[model samples]
Target: MNEERAASEQEAVENDVVARVLASFENTPDARLRLVMTSLVRHLHAFLREVRLTETEWESAIAFLTAAGHITDDRRQEFILLSDVLGASMQTVAINNPVSGGATQATVFGPFFVDDAPHVERGGDIALGAVGEPAWVEGVVTDLRGDPVPGARIEVWEADEDGRYDVQYADARVGGRGYLYSGIDGRYAFWGLTPTPYPIPFDGPVGDLLTATARSPYRAPHLHFMVSAPGLRTLITHIFVRGGEYLDSDSVFGVKESLITDFVVQDAGTPTPDGRELGGRTWSRARFDIVLADSE
Candidate 1:
């Protein structure tokens, strides 16, 4: 066929695909869902058109997606990792979470948060048997105006000094089930060895995709959180360690300037109820206030 004819045929195919997709959403009960799906299909097709994507490349992408799903299990979430690396997770947060003046910014929750983490008291150690620089994290959950949000619930999780989460280990008792929940007055504190920056899981298909794209896999050292209250929108965010090597180059593209905190090194001379003395030891401290939006 002539070049013009081939181009016309391609346009027809694209139009037909768009029509079918849009038609299927015509009766959608949810207005927001219909609008989002319609826009997604439009942009997706436009992207393919602009890139002049090949059949081989498209098939490869399909296979990659299939492999990502196949690798998911109760403990592993490949799709979230895929979204994170591709910046979709960040985009979703941006679109859904608009900052209200002084409200704390929202961020990606990451794929590692497990449900029902073991609850521990304030100042309890989440790093059970891990050896590294001790760190103290304390903060209050409040509104943009700095008013304390009493009874707010904040859940926390993070990797150990080795840059590994608890669920990643076969030995569940080791650093697994990290601390969760907040105390009275929306105050929460925990003790853990400082975590090191590490790469996301790279032994799987997601890794292969990143390798193919020449993208780095290192995420900045940070703690994960899910903060919520009775009358506010829940927040899923990370508190990045200041001065961490990967701060400016998070592999998952999840880091934000507002999220970075100075993990100050404290002397070991400080006394603790656990009988652990803060003598000449170094520790990191990050204090971030969570501001929740009033629920409608």
Candidate 2:
């Protein structure tokens, strides 16, 4: 709430309304939760006053949120989708992950992440029959100073050439996503579908909101990565295809210059890092060495 202006009696009543709501949280058990609630109330009330929100509009907002809740299930999360499109997800990530010692910058963690992704061995294929050209993804996990941080768990996922994640389908098949650990040398590798530009799931309330506001639902072509190791900040980020479409207008606004990287094309039968042949089929490869900051 703005603390100072020409105070009026009606405005005093309004300010008192805010004060009373804030006072309600005085007995909250958790200090952090109390502070967060207090801040939220202040902002929310300020918005209501600034916009002079109507009762009908408030009811509409409630209906929208109720629809979001109804659409959210074990495999789909409409609220995270809402947060992504609103830039809330990225804002939270930025606040928690400042530029520290040149560590890889964080970005939005999309709604599609799963708790127990299948494991992939070093240089093993994670595509699991998803459609797209084969690509080799290799990276090293390290500290800000570049020392190897072995045993870092690297979780990865992406959509297929047709721009659909596995979970978007009826079967919820686990393709195009998996996890692997860094080696003693801090190196990890896996095979995945080369990413393509794709839309966020657009059949829910988020989609209706975007349509009503003239927004595009497409995200830039990218592969998701979440790397974690003891004593280092866990990083949720994506490596976008350097020249992929929709880079400038990603629906979720997750593109970062430092995270855009090359997906170098390879000739059929090109010798892979592990010396595997592609049976005369062309492939692509990318290298993304990651750096982690010390945990806060």
Candidate 3:
């Protein structure tokens, strides 16, 4: 009887801590903020109770998070990478951007995305100095109804054959990234290096976490795109290599079946869609049409 009473008292003490923390949010003016904070506190406390987490474990977690913040910089975003690997980034994208009406599905806006990518002429090359298997990418931008959306801006960025973005380089001269506007027929095309599977930046605390958890840090090869036109919903997505390694096990959990695309291999002599030859070198061709939702 005495032991049972002690157990009940302990349970009441834990509940009191949770209740007091939740009560602190009562005066928050923002409805959303209050709700979020209360829910976060409840869930976090529940998790701690369930795990019977010790002080050492909590301190270690704080240290790990501090290390993640310390390592983040312009070229590297450790928090975003942490969220990506935890599936939080993709979950937020899915919750906020539902793919109704055949609109393109959204994925993680990876850390490598840069604002103001240089504009390129239709069918121009984006792989300025990068070395990789040449690839010709052609696509059209249209509404869900298949009507052409002329003058839509298409921004594209990808890692090189070595699985590294241009920003990773010291000079970062806009290689493997560019933009183009769709023609009246909604057609746009460009040349770029075929994206190869690459590991996420695994040199810091996040890397240590992944290693400790025995998780791979590799992401599937893919071409990132942000297609936008006036009065239409902007699309942020990626066309992944159909047979690329890591598609089944993307560390960021960003792959969707619809995004997988065939990259047809061709001999160097094969004429490009625009009837251009590439100095007698072999290349691949891929096409990805985007369907945008109405912003309203």
Query: What does candidate 3 score on TM?
Result: 0.96
lDDT of 3: 0.91
Which residue pairs in model 3 clash with each other?
268-281
lDDT of 3 by residue, 67-124 (tens): 9999999888999999999999999989888868898888888999888678899999
- Model 3, which residues run further than 4 Å from truth? none
**Higher-ranked by lDDT: 1 or 3:** 3
What residue pairs clash in candidate 1, if any at all?
268-278, 268-279, 269-278, 269-279
Q: How many backbone clashes does candidate 2 have?
A: 0
Stretches of candidate 1 above 4 Å error?
1-6, 174-184, 268-275, 278-281
Count of steric clashes across candidates, in order: 4, 0, 1
Query: What CA root-mean-square deviation does each model show from the true structure?
Result: 2.5, 3.3, 1.4
Decoy 1 TM-score against native:
0.89
Q: What is the lDDT of residue 29 in candidate 3?
A: 100
Per-prediction TM-score: 0.89, 0.94, 0.96
